[model samples]
Target: MSDTLTPPMQSADCWTRREIWQQPQTLNETQRLLRDNQGEIERFLRPLMEKTNLRIVLTGAGTSAFIGECLAPWLSRETGRRVEAVATTDIVSAPDLYCEGDTPTLLVSFGRSGNSPESIAAADIAAAKISDLHHLVITCNPDGALARDPGTHSHVVVLPKATHDHGFAMTSSFSAMMLAALSILSGVAALETRIDAICQAVSDILHNADTAMADLAQRNFSRVVYLGSGVFEGLARESALKLLELTDGGIVTAFDTPMGFRHGPKTFVTTETLVMVYVSNDPYTARYDRDLIAELRADNIAAGIVTLSAKAEADDTIAVRNLGGACDADLLFPYIVPAQLFALHASLARGMTPDTPNATGTVNRVVQGVHIHPLNP
Candidate 1:
């Protein structure tokens, strides 16, 4: 890892590194942008949210789709609405199954480029299937289809330009979109209160975690497993995908909830596996996470077990320094930093380009070669 951050300012100046390092600033800008636009957000959402039985469906493809999974549970509790995460890929493939025809629905679509065929198809399908449909598009490109072509029944929140990551694997785009969705859906004012701690923690991770992650990357673990619970499960999935994408499939990855792993996925682990657990801040959930970690350690089959946590649990814990008392939802932003760094380092160690790691041109930044079928009864 020649470019591995001793100076934290490599002469290469890759977009992947720039985007990964820029998260703290991008997140602050996202919150600020939301706060400034609070009036419009409330105006659009207030009425729909006030409806007797509204359904909020968060939908997108790939990394964008994971945003919904990460936020749906917390936002559902915060808003007391039926908030659900349905991937655009799923919605497009089987709109009849996921879309409720008569429901008063609000669709929050997340997209970096906003041009994925599935993303556009998902919105059209939702609109066609639901009678009272509203769209809230959170996207990076102002000129993107989702931002520019949203019909009169929609509102689009265009994130700061920096979040439109040029890299194949999403780094800043993931965090910024997740932050934007949380602030808008949960009340920007409320998130405003906690923004400083989240931003500071992320900044600290960027400043400090780079070298250690690089060192870990050089260890040459052929397999990696990421485990967590509830919202952290979604984070685990994103973390696994980051490594898979950045390493160009050179490193195999799996993601599961701490408890879910015992059911059978645990069989995937081997002597060459490196396991990372994203420990939940909730006491009850943390116990389950810790139990799994302990069980894996006792078995001693895996090469390593690392815990990403706000509270210290072991010698290998990558502590976020602050935010010990923060809710698990708040921990999401900072918890992802170490995973993002490791993926970047692993890509470099494997001699792949962090910005465009898929050498085969099979996987794309924005997916290609999909035929949209007629959604007929």
Candidate 2:
């Protein structure tokens, strides 16, 4: 923690900064909560898992949606069941495209507030379309419609209220919900150990790298690009959105896989752009990420490049320590911390109020102005 950094109580955009700083603690708290409720969660999921041909649909809006993307690949491989990441925004508008008429579906809904119109409507649409629909609602707001609704075969996991972010952007809420989902669905035996390692890694990053992150934010880049591979692709999307939202769209941003960036998105890179790559710990994936960083350095076209990695050969790379030899699935939690800090610092650097970046009020905390259509069965 830097002495110059404004205290949460004294800062103009207190909620956003405070929430960002509070993530490591909240993540541990979330892990403890999940452990305490493990019996109930497993009990609910056991019966659902017995059903043959089960299809798990992870759905949410925006950052919430990205959590599904991060989990789908890992969960699919672990559970040997079909896992799909479908945005609530997509399902609400076109339920038929996502939900099958007869599949035994588990719709895992992740919502910070649980109040987004799409959140409620997506669950309704899934129930209407899928004959054997089960829901696992992971959310922060206990009183929100998604949590309060008495839908059939639904189990709601409400995180601590402290996670219900007071800022326009989600900080603690997003990471906490993502942790809960992983703990419940992944069924890793050493989850407590993994949680401790993740917390330490994140805490170290926040403590040691604040100066560097703030310096990066102080740069004069007008555009930012975030790259990742596999499950990290979802994280890259969330990272890009965080920068865009916190900076209030003052900085243009893009997210793509390291290899995919060469196809067309590479053109977005320029002398005024800052590129950040979330390097995978998997040896095969790390090769491509390292190659991209090397190429970017060779070209010297971008203003700068930052790589967040568990392992890196470069001296200046942001290394996340105490990963507890976690696999890619477990690594996602710590990998996201740098991006969150970068977005917060960038917002402050650009004189944007992160707590309410959307000064015009077009974008809201719990999205407004969406009129849910009554689904006719």
TM-score of 1: 0.97
State the local distance difference test value for candidate 1.
0.89
Cα RMSD, each candidate: 2.9, 2.6
Give the CA lDDT, 0 to 100, for residue 352 in model 2.
81
Which residues of candidate 1, in runs, are more than 4 Å off? 1-7, 314-316
What would the per-residue lDDT of candidate 2 be over residues 1-377, giving only the tens digit for each residue? 22122223534547887887787778888888888888888899998888769999999999999999998998898888899999999999987788898889999999998999899989888888899889999999999999999399989999987899999888889889998988888773467768777877777777777778788898858999999998999999999999999988999999999999999899999999999898888888889988988898999899988888887565546888766356888778777878887888888888888888887889999999999988756
Give me the candidate number with maximum lDDT: 1
* Predicted structure with the largest TM-score when compared to the true one: 1
Expressed as tens digits, the lDDT of each residue in 127-194 for candidate 1 is 88899999999999998999989866899999999899998888889999999999998889999999
TM-score of each: 0.97, 0.95
Supply candidate 1's per-residue lDDT for 158. 98
